[model samples]
Target: MSYLVLARKYRPRNFGEMVGQEHVVQALTNALTQQRLHHAYLFTGTRGVGKTTVSRILAKSLNCQGADGSGGITATPCGVCQACTEIDAGRFVDYTELDAASNRGVDEVQGLLEQAVYKPVQGRFKVFMIDEVHMLTNTAFNAMLKTLEEPPEYLKFVLATTDPQKVPVTVLSRCLQFNLRPMAPETVHEHLVRVLGTEQVPAEPGALRLLARAARGSMRDALSLTDQAIAYGNGTLAEAGVRQMLGSADRGHVHRLVEALAQGDGRTVVETVEAMRDAGLSAASTLEEMTAVLQAMAVLQAVPARAAQQDAGDPDAQEAARLAALMPADETQLLYSMCLHGRAELGLAPDEYAALTMVLLRLLAFKPAAEDGATEKKTLLNPAPPAEARPPAPAPVARAEPPAVVVAPQLPEPPAPAPMPAPLAAELPPPTSAAPAVQAAGQRLPVVDAPRRPAAPTAPA
Candidate 1:
């Protein structure tokens, strides 16, 4: 037999086999048992979250016959029946899957609708499963609106799309919508363990953990990566090999970087980046790992009790708790923000490693004053002076003004200028009352005009 990739080979055979989608499964199961079926169903979520899988299981439930070929519709399908077996193999005539991404025109939609008029040939109900239904054009969507809103009792519609926003609201209104969320990393990890156990492949827990994190909540992606990791490791999965394949930085380097950052040690930070570069590690991955570690540190700092509850076996958690105590909460938050945003900066620089170095150094450049030995500088620059040496602050004066008018006090005229001394007066010419006043020695007196001078001048003219 040819080789089968883990993703396809381990595809969920039924709803019971599905993981991390209990909410969706429970609702569908109850609905199936109660026979409360909608004419059209819309499954929305990110890629590889089992939107199509749920649809297939639902189709099987509606068409399943018993092992003895005497069964009616059921929540659990008998996999042995022709209808269930054919649907699983994708060869069932009644279960038709259309890849809307390729055939997204009105013609294709109309052609599919033409099949709707006919009843099921080999199953209880005719299922039309359209994958990536969001890719269908507006005209195609409009053409199917009427049929989708009110389809025949024997016909069923199952639409799956990664982007539900693009799926027209008109179609959305007619169908029952269920949003399948991405699986948690822990869920993906546990599922990987089970799948690998069944495959009889030996994998380290750390390797599986790395793969789960790299999968980013996609089980299909997790399985696919496991297959690659197994191949890369020559039949067994190891943390070092998986990390190398994913280009993920070592946790040791990440912890060292965080510890260096917490200590405000720029030299250690630079040396760590150099070691990472020498090892051919990705700068982006380093920042990504740093962000993760920093986030945990921040959480631990905020909730000190979380440290006790964290996985005791996980060295990363213990290291994070140690660093969390070493760094202040505010600095932890600042570094987390920087590392989170620094991933985008890696691509903008000419050399990604150089950019990574700058990003790491940025935390030191903006280190908190208390941590950077600036607290003393702040105190020295703004020290309080002695009371006597300090200039007193000016008191605030209240301003009030009198009316705009002035009056001078009256005084009796000085007693006729107190008659000059007789001897000094005699030395001076006789003074005219209006003009002349005697002065003391070395002081000059005003001159008085002689009365006859004007007459003498007039006679000469």
Candidate 2:
């Protein structure tokens, strides 16, 4: 037998064999079991999310004969029957698959629609599986609209696309659409373990983890990478080998970069970049990993409950929680945004490693100052006047003492004082009991020779 790639070799054969996309599977399974099947079914999702796989399984479910050739339509397909075996071998006469990407023309579409008039030659129903159907031109789409909306009873139209937006809404409304979600890392990891175990291949858990993460939620991609890893390891999968093959930095390096960034250690970040360069790791991959870590941290900061419920044994989750606690929520979001945009900057810089350094250091640049409530520089509202050089305020000092006198500017002499009445003069105190005198605005009372001279003057007279 010729060598088969892992992606094809481990391709999901039936609904039961599929690992992810349980929601789509459940709906389709119920439809099949209850025989509430729709004539037109549309599957949409990214590549490797089982868009085509689901269509094939549905075909098998409808056409599979039981072990003794006595089975009617079922949710579970019996692989022993002729129809099931032929479909699995991709030689079924009634099941047709069209690659719209290559044959996206009105004539091609019209030719496909013509098959609806004929009945299934070998199976219970004829399945027209169109992959990447969104690539079909508007004219091609128009040609098949009537048939797609109302196909023959014995014919099932399965249209799959990665982008549903490109597919006309008119056509979309005619089919029962089901979206297949990308597989989770854990789900992909478990599936890789199962496949490796079945192949009797010796593999390390860490290697499988790296593969799962590298897959980015694509089971086909995950398996294909595993095949490369196994060959790279010469039949054994090791973390070190897989990491080298993927050209990603060591997990510890990513953690250290994140921790250093959270602590605002620019020196450590730069050194990490140097270390990664020395290890020959890809700069793009380093940023990629950082983006992932930062995103997880953001989620942890945003929703604590969700992060708390994450699997305890997952080191990535634990580290994310720790980082989220270490950094403020706003900082977490900032770092995440920078890392995401940094991936594009790697190519523009003079050197990618240098760009990586800047990207990591960006967080430190925008990070708030230490929250320890210690002002970096003391700023006084009114800085204490240079009190050492000058005495205390003169206003307060002057208020503490009595003013002897307040002299007015020099002026002309004032007019002489007038004589007092005799009755008022009798009420005056002795001359020895003198009171202090004050001058009016610019006038002074002049002293008149007392009447003392009057007695002497009378005697003289």
Candidate 3:
């Protein structure tokens, strides 16, 4: 018998098996029980967040039959029925799943829509499930708008996409939309524990926590990673193995680095980074770990009681709280921002370890001085002035008066006449008869003269 992977083997068969999507499940369950079904349904979310799974479960709900083969539309499908079994196996005649990513042209869409007129061949309803529906072309979308908006009573449409924004508003308006949120780490962790228990695989709690955080809220990814971890650990998942597999820095190192940074201990910071590098740990991962610790420290600093209550059982939480108290709130925030942005700098540098060292040192370089240290800094920057060699103040001098001279009045100078062109000078009239020359001795009249024109006549002769 061929072995099925955990993701496929444990795929949810009905709404009851779905996880991390209570809001969606409740809404759908109520709608199903009341028979308030829409012609078109759109499920949107990130990858592996149950978009496709929800679509399959919805299809089974529409077509499920009881063991005795006498069932109507139901919120819970009987997996034993031919309709439910075939749909789960992906071989149902009426439940058609189209991968829009590959067959996104108008011809394919029209071909699929061509079947909308026909009745169901083997089930109560004909379900057309289109995955990654956003990949469909504009023309393809337009091709099915009329049918999607007004489908037959026996026909239903299920569209799923990671990016709902790419889907045209026209198509979006024709469907009932449900956003499936990413599962929380805690949710993923609980699910993994159940899954590993079923598989009879022994995994440490710390290892599971690491996997959950690494999964970043994807159940499918968490399971896939568990499969890899089990194989790597030879069926036993341990913290050290998972850490090495993930190239994650140890919490001890992260805590040490944070403490060193808080205390302005550069040597410890450098040593911690070197140890991480020696262990072949990722620089980016180190920064990521520091950012996480700093973030926790910040939260604990901000709301100590609440954070304590939330992280009461976490082994590292106590240490985080300790560091939170040790470092000032402002410095914690500053380091958090630096570590967050420092990850981007790792790729730009030639050596990632060296870059990590620089990023850590950068926080120390910019760390705010303490109150006592501020005074010391001021003294260093501006020392006291010398006292013995101070210069003496000078005496004020007496004012003196200048000697008086005999009075001698002077007359104002006369104004100069303006020059004129020779031709204009020749054409000028004599001084005005109305004016009296030398009426005032200080005012003098100036004469003007024009150049001779005799040379012109001599050349002609």
Clashes of each: 0, 0, 0
Any residue pairs clashing in model 1, and if so which?
none
lDDT of 1 by residue, 85-121 (tens): 8888999999999999999999999999999999999
lDDT of 2 at 246: 94
In the range 148-214, model 3's lDDT, one tens digit per residue, is 9899999999999999999999999999999999989999999999899999999999999999999
User: lDDT of model 2 at residue 93?
Assistant: 92
Name model 2 segments beyond 4 Å from true: 298-329, 368-461
lDDT of 1 at 73: 84
> Where does candidate 1 stray beyond 4 Å?
369-461
Q: Give RMSD (Å) of candidate 1 vs. truth.
A: 7.9
| TM-score for each model | 0.83, 0.78, 0.81
The residue pairs found clashing in candidate 3 are: none
Order candidates by TM-score, high to low.
Answer: 1, 3, 2
Model 3: what TM-score?
0.81
> Each model's C-alpha lDDT?
0.87, 0.84, 0.88
